[model samples]
Target: MSSFEIYGGKKLKGELTVQGAKNEALQVLCAPLLTAEKVTISNIPDIVDVNKLIDLLQTMGVKIEKVERGTYVFQAKEIDLSYLETEDFKKRAGSLRGSIMIVGPLLARFGKGFIPKPGGDKIGRRRLDTHFDGFALLGAKFNYDAGEHFYSIEAKKLKGTYIHLDEASVTGTANIIMAAVLAEGTTTFYNAACEPYIQQLCKMLNSMGAKISGISSNLLTIEGVKELGGCYHRILPDMIEIGSFIGLAAMTQSEITIKDVSWENLGVIPNTFKRLGIKLERRGDDIFVPAQDSYEIDTFIDGSILTIYDAPWPGFTPDLLSIILVVATQAKGSVLIHQKMFESRLFFTDKLIDMGAQIILCDPHRATVIGLGRQHKLRGIQMTSPDIRAGVSLLIAALSAEGKSVIHNIEQIDRGYQDIDIRLRNIGADIRRIN
Candidate 1:
């Protein structure tokens, strides 16, 4: 476990480049495993989640060569199927949630995929029913060895069919698409997740010769091809990180410019921040957020208090609700932060409430923040990070607080953010990583 020590009340300045999308990178990294040819990927974020996926691939005998800091070439020339049953493989596979994605590619190319129950941040019940259901819909036999506690799917040959997902699962759709692209005939996915990350995965697969249609929509059609060839793919900018930065600038009253933000892809994220009354300027490809002393929340059409909630793609991402809740802490008005996707995500509001912010944790799913109007600065205190998004939210709070703050178990933060402390320091953030 690691910790972050921060001396509070520093208004940061200068610029920070948003890292490549961690979510998209995780999906695209698994695409190459569907082919034996070499695949080149650029703009790869060096985060724990992505690196852990890369390591999983390496353990399965995928050849990966680094082209540069954010570039790599991967070739799945050979894979050890038997290695998947090893204790070493099961232990490592269970460590990362993204490792579940390997199931689709392996089942597509080798007719079988195996994994121990996957692990990730214990935010809520992230069900794999959508994943296995999609695979079963694609003509794969789903099986679980209760004695070994292993889940697997196998098929003599995958044939495409119509699948209406129980939920619009992002990773589940990606896994199904990966499997479908190599199956016979066409596959239709209704109620599909249309997030930018999923769209990027579709495009990367198309470049690799997978025929996918209805991108950026809830309904998708995939024309299965005999095989997919390797191609170069670059990931999109991380929207979660950009949202965190927006909250950072507003919370710390800092003038900061976010570089190479991929403005076209951010959907409703920028506008969501504007609803918090933060001043944001779109400078070409970058977003310049000016320092703010006080900002007020906007009400709904019926004069109700502002409510921020999450939905499927092309909507507000649930990942940023933590940041939004933190930023609203110092705003001039009240707003209800609704995290409908995950049950335990909003539980960390207790820590924010402990730090002198007026917050009411209505339940495991919602919190209402009564803004302090910047009349009083928060006095920092020691706290442990409950999860990745909450960790960054606490960091933002600590940065704007009046005293020192200590955050333990920051490895949760490291899993998604790439060199976050270093990047923040480049823009005048007073934070340090310590053992």
Candidate 2:
């Protein structure tokens, strides 16, 4: 258990480059398991989740070697799907949400797969029901035992069929697509998740000889192929990290530039930021954030405050809402923050309140933030991080606060962002990581 001791209230001013997306890198790393040939990946972030995923892949007999700092050569030429039965695999499988991603590729290649209950943040009850439902519709029979939390899937010859997902679950859609890609017939996925991660997965699958159309749309049609081969693909830049940097610059009142931001891939992030009064300067492909004292929140004409809620793709991401909530404390007007995907995400607001943020916890899913609008300077205090996004939210709060603050459970923050303290420190952030 390491913690962060931050002496805040300093403007972090410097140019920082965003790393590769964690969400995209996680799935792409698993894509290598679909083929026996070597696959090269660049721009992979050096983070805890990525490390854990690499470890899991190694357990399944995939050979991974680092070519450079943020690049790697992965060859899944010798895969032992039976490694899923080991205690080490079971432990790692239960701790990472991305472990479930292996089920689809394994089932497609070996005609069977076994996985334990996957884990990540304790935000809410993210049911595997949709994942199982999608697999069932793809001609797989599943058995779940609660005491072991083990899931087993078996299919002799997968036949593609029309599947309308219960909801637009990202991982579920991906699992179904992976299984459907190797089936005998055509598979149509309606109301599928079209997030950048899913799109990247689709691109990787297509490169491997899987016939997939509608890369950016919700409806995906996959023509089953007999096999796939290794192909080179680069992971996308992290949009959540990009959004986090925007929140960081706004909170610190610092001028910063986000380099190499793929503006074309960012669907609704610009509009979402505009609603919170953050403007961007698009110079070619890069984004520049100018220094600002405060921003005004958008409100309705009826004189009632509106809430910014999270939804599926083409909507604001639920992951970045925590950062937005923390940034809103320094904005000009009040707004409601709604996290529809998770139940416990709003609980972290208690720490912000102790640091002098004016927030009303409406319920498990919503909170009303009446911004002091840069008029009140929050004083530093000791706190513990709860999850990944909330941990980053607390870090942002600490950076904006006055005096010194001690943040325990910094490992939570480290899980997603690599060398965050080191990176921020380069930009004049006074943060020290201590164990």
Candidate 3:
């Protein structure tokens, strides 16, 4: 097991570039299978999840070559169907949730796909109903094996139709879109997720000769094409990382600049930080956060305590709620954090409480953070990272604390954030990764 040993109470100052979007890379990496030509993708983060997916693809005989640091060329001219039934495939593909997305392209191109119950963070119940239902709507026969915790979807041919998602699920939207691009008829998806990742996926598909409209809106219409060709796509900046750095600067009283943060795509992330009274300046395509002595939380106009919650697109994402909740611990006013999407995401507040922060856990979904406003410094302690978002939040708290803090199971952090400790160290954070 690896751990991060962080020494706190020092202000950080420097500039750092945000890595490519991890979630988007997960979907885009699976996109090349729609065609027989080579697809080159740039700005892909070398994280555990991405690597796991690449390994799973390699096992299926999908020829992939890393052209450079963050660039890869994928050619799916031939895929080995026999790999799907192997014990190695079962062990490797089942380790990451993104592996499920492969089924969409596999079923689209080969008409047969099987996915084991994929796993990632144990945050909540992430159901695959939307994905399977969309495939069934496209004429795929779907079945589940309870004993093996597996799903089987097969179709001789796919015929697209109207699919209104019960919720705006990102992966589900990407999967269905991949499946429908090569189907027989036009597919109209209402209530689709319009996150930048989804938009990029649609745009990439369009570049590959697929017809898709309503790029930025929740309603998407895709015209089926005969085949998809090779395309080049560069993933966008990690907005979650940008938000994490914003919280890190504020909580550590650091003056940090985040480079090339595609402002057009970060709809509500910046303003959400502004609501917490954290000062940030937009520098061209970058974000400049100055060292803050203290910041005050903004309450509602009716004098209610400030509340931050997650919602669909153009809304505050649940991914950064843990960061915001941790930063709120040192702010001037109290705020309520409502994690509506995942029931167990807010449970990480208990770790912050152990670090001398004032937080009241209302329930599994809600937590009220009473800011200490740097009046009392947090004392460092040993902790384990529960999930990706919560792991970074704990790391930020450790940086703002008084002594040494040790965070174990940093693999969760590595799964999302690439080289987190190294990047933080370059920015003057006293952190080291122990193998």
TM-score of each: 0.99, 0.98, 0.99
Per-residue lDDT tens digits for candidate 3, residues 1-435, read: 999999998999999899999999999999998888999999999899999998888888889999999999999999988889788888998999999999999999899898899999989989999999999999999999999998889999999899999999999999999999999989999999999999999999999999999999999898898899998999999999999999999999999999999999999999999999999999999999999898999989999998899999989888999999999999999999999999889888888999999999999899999999899999999999999999999999999999999999999999999989999999899999997
> Residue 127, candidate 1: how far off, in angstroms?
0.6
In candidate 1, position 127 carries an lDDT of: 85
- A best-first ranking of the candidates according to their TM-score comes to 3, 1, 2
Clash count per candidate = 0, 0, 0
Could you give me the TM-score of model 2 versus the true structure? 0.98
Per-model CA lDDT versus the true structure: 0.92, 0.89, 0.93
**What range of 10 consecutive residues in model 2 has the weakest lDDT sum?**
80-89
Q: Pick the candidate with the highest lDDT.
A: 3
**Candidate 2 Cα misplacement greater than 4 A, ranges:** none
Ranking by lDDT: 3, 1, 2
RMSD of 3: 0.7
- Quote the positional error of residue 410 for candidate 3 in Å: 0.5
Candidate 2 lDDT by residue in tens digits, 247-325: 9998988888888889888878877777889877888888899988888888878978868999999888899999989
Question: Measured by TM-score, how close is model 3 to the native structure?
Answer: 0.99
Candidate 3: stretches off by over 4 Å:
none
TM-score of 1: 0.99
